[model samples]
Structure formats: structure tokens, C-alpha cells
Target: MSAGPEIRTIFWDVGGVLLTNGWDIDQRGRVLTALGVDLAAYEAVHDEVNFFWERGLISARDFFERTVLETNPQLALTFEQLWKLVCDESKMLHPECFEMIAHLRRAGSYRLATLNNESKELNRHRIDSFHLRRFFDYFICSGYIHEMKPLPEIYRAAIDISGFAAETAIFIDDKAENCDAARSFGMIPIHFQSPAQLRVSLAQLGIAI
Candidate 1:
């Protein structure tokens, strides 16, 4: 197997696979703790609004207003402040992963893209802030498509948008559910553990990087 017809494309997950999560549970906990916000109260509202929020149906301000702020009225954090905290969590970039992305690009071996579940603003922040466009060809984000992972719709959309047969593509993500979903869709799934492990797995498919 080579990086020719065998593996024509690579679909990466932005949050865990390529970068830190935009606003996952760990990131939310850190940001909320720093602001002295109640976790239980915040999660209650977060669960209510997150589905629509990530689907790009609501603006950043509205998402904040509906989530944490709605539950904790005394919290004086502004939308910008809260959004910044969420974006900052994604700043912990993985150098090895980045290097591999660059290597794949330089090899000109396959199509590279990102498939992630995040809000529009935070997704844009991570994309531009991390210069993801430098390597990835497409950004199949939940914000734009209104489809999240572990769902057949999102996997189908991603496969269609890539213009490659799912069997010829590889989907890399940290979540077992997401990976399982990809496998069910006929796309190869790499349950990303670390950069080193990822490299080994890809190497098995003749994708050196």
C-alpha cells in the first residue's frame, strides 16, 4: 500500500487529534474554575445550548449568555473574556503532529483535511490562530455543516466533501466513538493516542508521515 490510490486522503480531528480541544470538558473545567463559577450550574446550561451552539445556530455572545452566565448571574465575565479562555486552551499545539502534517504536505502524497465539532468562532480561532490552512485542504467543521461526530451524517458529509471514496481515506480522532463511527462509514479509523503511535499506524498504511 502506498499513498496513491490506497490512501488518497487523511481526515483529521482538530480538537484532540491535531490540537487540544476547542472547548471540551477539561477546557471548560479549567476556565470555569478560574472564574469561580459553579461547575454543576455551568454544565446544566452548557448541555442545553451546546448542541445548537456548535451547530452555528447561535452567536458566541448568545452562547455565553445562555450557558454559564445564565446559570451564574453574579459571574461578571464578558463574552470576549470567556471566549478567549476557550480559545486559549487550544493553543497547546502538538509540535510532533504539526511536523507530521508539514511532512505530509511536503510529500504531496495525499489530501489533508480537518473534521471537527466546534462552534464557528472557536473553530475559526483555532484554524487561523494555528495556521491550519497551511497544511489542510478542507475544514469540515460542525459549525459550518451543523453536523457533529459519531453521527453518520457528518461522516458522509466529510467523505463527500473530500471527493474521495471513504475506503481510500483515513480518519484520525481521539475519541473511540468518533473512530468507531468512521470505521462504520468504511473510512479507516486511527484512534489517536500520541504523535508517535499515530506515525506508526499511518506507516502501516504506507503513509510515512
Candidate 2:
């Protein structure tokens, strides 16, 4: 049989692309301060908890409970409170980035989808609040998939659902490791820094801005 047809899909990572400046460094600092935890200590806790969460080894609630127990026992906070704190600290979507996605969607040249490492509740808010669901052909949330970025299974799932071949797909993400992971799967991975840079890079790839 002939080889599979070329992929013509674009998979975007939501946090850095659509939700610009959302996960700001200062916001993390603020979260730590509000929790009465040291920055280094909080980071260590976050790393550990996030590792388990990303690997699908634990539920978000469990991760939060364990994180608080190990990192900030002095605070005496519940999982719900911690969840609210983290959610509240994140910024909203940037208008320009939303416009960019709109442009890509309306251009009708590529199949667009979003793969985000976000909780189901938060993603629901994002989708509804921003009316983002209307723009993409598919939206995959890690919480629903129980798999997160840098994981081949999650990427494969997105590809399978989109019915797109690996080579024809272009994946955009802010993290180098995530981009590298997509490249390993034979996708054209674009490291996203800014909208202007993305325009230039996509133009180089013969994708209209």
C-alpha cells in the first residue's frame, strides 16, 4: 500500500499560545507568598506534584493534598482552597493571540486543535468564558485524557483523533521539551515566543499568517 498521506493539521498548546502571560513568574511568586511558603520549597513541591499529575499517577485533588502536606503544612489549607488559589493566580487569554487563532481558523488551510495541560474545570471556564470551542476542530484537555505534555501517548491521541499524519502536522508550544517531543513524533514543531516571531516562522514554512 502507498504511504499515509501528508498531514495538514496544526495542534496548539493553549497555555502559552492562547493564554499569553497567564503563567507569569510573578504570579507564581505571589501564590507562594499568599500560601506562606518559601519560593524554593514551593517550587520543589510543585515539581513533585506536577510530575505525578502529568504522568497520570494521581488525581488533581490527591496531588494538591500531598503537595500541601509536604510543602506548606503550616498553612492549614484544604485542597479546595489550594485549587482556588492556583486558579485565581493564572492570567486570562490574550486578545491578540485569540485573534491569531481566529485568523488560522478562518484561513481554512489547516486543521486546528488545542492540546492543553489544564484541569477540566479550568479548561471548561476557559472554553466557555472565551468562547474558544468555536475556533478549533478539536480540544483535548490533559485532565480529561489523563495524560499531559511531553508524553507521546497524548500527542498520538491528538493525531489519531484529528486523523492527520504526523509529518503534515505542525505543533506549536512554548516549552522546548514539549516541542522536542512533537518533533520526535515527526511533527513540525514550532517553538512559540511571540506572535510576530510566530508569523515570521509560519511564513517561512509557507503557512499564511
Candidate 3:
């Protein structure tokens, strides 16, 4: 499992790793309550609707409309309002994770890139506000590619752009399934749980912390 010194590319997941995703279940309940929707009533549908959107089976507009109708049937809110709430609640960058990225970039040992399942609006916001675009050699967003991961093509695209062989690339993702996908494609996969865990894993892979 040695990465060896030739490993020159690293791909990162956005949600749950770079950004905070899915509000605390408790906090989500509170928000639903404020919106006059019963937390338990909408929970399952909310989860399913998001899954559909992430899988690219449904458009964002359809997802938003369905969510408003199923979750807050009594409330009168436009699709714009629903979109803003959902995006704002799910999208937040962890400072510690950003600091680690800064550290990696400073080391200049790997070509950094992001492969994320995110909307264009959220991606643009991150690029501008986080200035994350400056740190990466490439940024591949699902919305832009029309291909969300754990798909091989998305990973291949990143690999091709960075000009790194899959065998010599490292991928960091919060989801076990996504990590497994990378591993299946012959890239070294690091299952990231926290900034500390990621640092330890990268160090183990001989990536300077």
C-alpha cells in the first residue's frame, strides 16, 4: 500500500469533508418546526429528495418544488426561498479543513483538485469566498460534468487533467462508497473522518503533514 514518492495528485470531496453538510438532525428538526412542518413527517422525504437530486435523476427546480409541497404544504414559499434555505443550511466550510488544505498546498508535493457533487451556485460561492480555486490545479464539479461520483468517469477526468496515473493518485472522501470507488479505480483512497484523521492518514501515506 505504499504510495511511493511518485504520487503527485490528490482529489478531495467537497461536502462533509471540505464543507459541513446535513445540519445536525436536532437542528434540522428545529428549522422544520419554525417552518411549521412536523420534523418526523418530512424527514424521510427530505432525505430521499436530496438523494434523487445528487444522483442527477431530478432537476434542482423539481426537487425544490417537491420538497416545498411535501414538507411544508401549508406554508406559502417560492422555489427561490426553498433553494436559499436548503443551500444555506447545507453549505459551510470548516476552517480546520481549509487550514489543512493550506498546509498541503504549501508543501507543494501534490497537485490538489476538488471533485464534488454540488450545485453551481454553491461551487461558485466556495470558489470566490474560500479562494479555493487558487489552491487547486483543477476543480471538477458534478453540476458542470453532469456526472456525480462514485462514478469512474469523474475520477478519470480528474486524473487526466492532472496528468497523473490512477495508481499514483490519492483521493480523500468522507463517504466510504466514494472511497471504495477510488480504490476500485486503482487510486489510493483515504476515508476522511476529520481533519486530524486525514492528517494522520496522509502522513501514513508518506504525504508530509
Candidate 4:
């Protein structure tokens, strides 16, 4: 068997692979439930302009206005309050993932970055709260890039931003579809399941944690 290209760069997915999905409806529900707002109605509005919000075409305030405030003029919760509740939902799903990333970072063997679909508010909250900057060299998220996962552009952007060839890159995402897209884009892809399985997968790729 032939050896594959060396993995020089790693692109991580933030929401699922490393932390609790910032997109969980429950995250929204927490804030809405507090404000006596309807989750279904708010979610319907979110589904409509989510692309704009994630693509950096709209601000978080705008998203809240369109989704919450506009529909319910009497909404008692302030944007800041609602923001904090959803932000609270963003937690480290696997401490093992953090330890692994830290070890890899110390090894100085791979360039680290994140490729994810998230709005600016959610992305910033996780990055700040989790101190993710300690591991990742940069973040290639949809919030700033105006592109989302499962799209070829965001994957390419990660490679471009990392200044590495796609063949030398690996993308780790919890979504099989996103992993498939990364594979099609000429990068090694790992469909992350859990910390234990992830360790095994990384070992298979010659990356021992």
C-alpha cells in the first residue's frame, strides 16, 4: 500500500465536534422560554433569514429583530439578555477534544483552524468562552466568510487561509455530509462520533494523542 500525503493542517468544526451544537433549538428555546416567546414562530423566522445571518450579510441584532422583536413587539427580554442565555448553551462537549488539540498544538506538527457554519454572535461566544484561541491558529467560520459547510468554497477557504495544499489537510466534522464534501474537495475527512472513536480515527491517520 502507498502512503498518503502528510497531514500538515487540520480544520475543525466548532459546533458539534468540539462543543455543544450552538445551533440547537434548545439553545433558542432557553431564551424564548424565559421571555414567554414561541419557539416555533421564532424558528420559522430564523429559517428564513438564517443564510443572511450566517453569511455575515446581517448582524445578530438584525436577526433578533426579524425573528423575535418584529413578531412580538412586547418581547420583554433585551437582546443582551437573550444573547447571554444562548451563549450559555455553548459548552465544551468533550474535554478530551480540547486536551488532544492542546497536545497537537504543543507538538507543533500541524496548523490548526476551524471551518464551521455559525453566526458571528454564536461563534464569538464560543471562541471567547472556551478560550479556543489557545488551540486554533485561526477560525474560518461562515459568520465572517459568508459561506457555510457542505459548500466547496468554505473548505477551499480554509486551505487558502492556512496557506497549505488541500491534499495535506484534514477536516474533522460531526456531520457525514460535511465530511463527504471535504473528501470531494481533496482533503482527508473524519466523521467525528465521540472522543473515544475520534482518538481511534486519529490513530488510524497516524496521529496519536
In model 1, which runs have C-alpha deviations exceeding 4 angstroms?
Answer: 1-5
After superposition, candidate 2 runs with Cα above 4 Å error: 1-7, 20-26, 55-57, 69-78
TM-score of each: 0.93, 0.80, 0.79, 0.95
The alpha-carbon deviation from the true structure for residue 188 of candidate 2, after best TM-score superposition, in angstroms, is: 1.2
Tens-place lDDT per residue, model 4, 31-129, is 678788888777777777888998888988888878887788786667787667667778788888999999999999999999999998888888888
The TM-score that candidate 1 achieves is 0.93
The model with the greatest TM-score is: 4
In angstroms, give how far residue 52 of model 2 lies from its true place.
2.7
lDDT of 1 by residue, 13-106 (tens): 8877777787889988998899998888788778778999898899888988877776677877778778787777886557899999999999
- Model 2 residue 46 lDDT score: 77
Give lDDT: candidate 1, residue 195.
91
- How well is each residue in 110-207 modelled by candidate 3, as lDDT tens digits? 78999888656567666775677777878887767767788888777777777868888889988999999988988889998888888888778877
lDDT of 2 at 161: 87
RMSD of each: 1.8, 4.1, 3.2, 1.5
The local distance difference test score of each candidate is 0.86, 0.75, 0.74, 0.86
